[model samples]
Target: MCSNYDACTKPERLRMYFGVEPPPRIKSQVWPLYEAPFIRRHPHKDVGDDAVPAREAVAGLFGLIPHWAGEMTFGRRTYNARSETVAEKPSFRDAWRNGLHCIVPVECIYEPDWRGGKAMPTRIQRKDGKPIGIAGLWTSNTKATGDEVFSFTMLTVNADDHALFKHFHKPGDEKRMVVILREDQYDEWLDAPASRSMDFMRQFPAELLMATAEPDRGKKTR
Candidate 1:
């Protein structure tokens, strides 16, 4: 699962890449519980008209905070939801059932390569150096202090048979990778219903991704 990643924080880049106006300020690096921007279908889009934009960008915590969560700390462990159990897990079921699909725009994703009997942080990005749009779920919650908080979680799929992602994680552990969507599928993914959302939860092509072994420099904090 991806717990840390480089976000596409520039407003102009976000506008061009995701087709939405992002928040004025967004962090470059995102960790669990960190603030980041996600693109989702406009809530009022159903009001009917081409005048309403189909998509909108909103800033939210990187992790997911279920409605039943008592505090923001609950998000720390909900950053990544397994596709197999997302619809059954307490932390993700509500969002999944409600079809709260979203796209998490990222410059690259960081994962650990556990070869050579040690762990090496690897930076994985598209071969073209373009931003990736990862599939995720978003939800809104009310805090004990009467503040409303929006949060999201990246959806992950089993990658045990994947050519590239199979090398990540521990030797015996199950391999997993985030669901990356193609540019053409962006709108389709957001508009997919709950029953069909899983159709997009598949691994990205290994040939389109390039990885470099770069150690974490303590620049990102949890």
Candidate 2:
């Protein structure tokens, strides 16, 4: 699962790439619960049957906040919802069935390799360094204070057989990676029915992937 990532896209680039208006400037890096932009169909308030889904860019927290959550802290652990069980998991099932699909724009994602008795942070991205659109589910919550919280969780699939992805996570843990949609597949992914959405959950070609080892700044000092 991804604990942090780089999603720093400029407003103009967001418009150029996703065709939606830009959200607020995101930091160079984003962590769980940090707000970031996502492309998704806007919630329609029109009562008419003529209403259509409109694509829009909106800022939402990286972690999902199920409407049933009594508090926001639960988001910390829901940043990623496994694709295999998302349709059945209580936290994500509702959104999954309701077609709350979203696309998370990521420049790169960070993971920890615990092979040498300690974790080494690795940055994974497309070989060309272009932003990748990760498939995700989003939901909204209203706080007691009248504030509304919009959040999302990236969907991941097993990547055990993937040459590149299988190298990131801890040794004994299951290998998994976020579902990255090709540019041509974005529209289909966003508009597909819930029943057909999972059909798009598959491993990306490792040939297009690249990785770099980085110092683990979060590692404790002696």
Candidate 3:
């Protein structure tokens, strides 16, 4: 539930860390990241619209693969393609067929509490400015150019202790959070599946996350 991040007030910080510029206007109730064209730094590699990596795992925009595609809208259905059942659902089954692979580069994600007296906004981020990748599933969407445009959904699993203890999540519900991956886990998550996916996901350390409140701009730190 680390959703309360407002303005990317630290634009200069983002630029320094990401090496790419921040959004022209730093805003969004829910931030938007899209597939755009880019040239990679590696002189030997190819760079183009299809080559650009996604900024964040924007849920559901990317559909599941091997689509039976019986007249379904992409946006509504694609938002959450869970890891546990990706192999079972018809929509995602084929995606799981060859094994779905995707990465969502997230700044932060927020969640609200309807039962609370006053809603609190918290901003969660790594202490270091290292850009992290959240695991996801992707399908190839065709664009006018005929180059395969890939859209993906970030995977979510039960929240760890930090989140449950932070006054978020349903009382008894295991509740879910986006699956943020450690650098070491990327290969398996984006490569192997079914057998290895669950095992690799469990490797995340519970102690790495610090979920807390964002106080007023002065005096206190989030």
Q: For this target, which candidate reaches the highest TM-score against the unseen true structure?
A: 1
Alpha-carbon runs more than 4 Å astray in model 3: 1-66, 70-72, 113-115, 142-149, 160-166, 212-222
Better of 1 and 3 by TM-score: 1
Prediction 3 global C-alpha lDDT: 0.47
Best by lDDT: 1
lDDT of 3 by residue, 27-106 (tens): 32332232311111222224556555423222223333234343334433555556677678776766656665655445
Clashing residue pairs in candidate 3, if any? 3-110, 57-104, 60-78, 60-79, 62-151
Better structure of 2 and 3 per lDDT: 2
Clashes of each: 0, 0, 5
Model 1: colliding residue pairs = none
TM-score winner between candidates 2 and 3: 2
Per-prediction TM-score: 0.95, 0.89, 0.59
- List residue ranges in candidate 2 displaced over 4 A: 44-54, 143-145, 216-222
Pairs that collide in candidate 2 are: none
- The model with the greater lDDT, 1 or 3, is 1
Per-residue lDDT of 1-222 in model 2, one digit per residue for the tens?
Answer: 887888747776666667667677455578887878888976662434444435677888888988878788778899999998999999899989988899998888898877667788888889986788999999888862257888899999998899988887777789999999998888888888898988989999989988888875463211
* Positional deviation of residue 7's Cα in model 1 after best superposition, in angstroms: 0.8
- Cα lDDT of model 1 by residue, 41-128, tens digit: 9999999888888898889999999987888989899999999999999999999999999999999999989996788989999999
lDDT (Cα) of model 1: 0.91
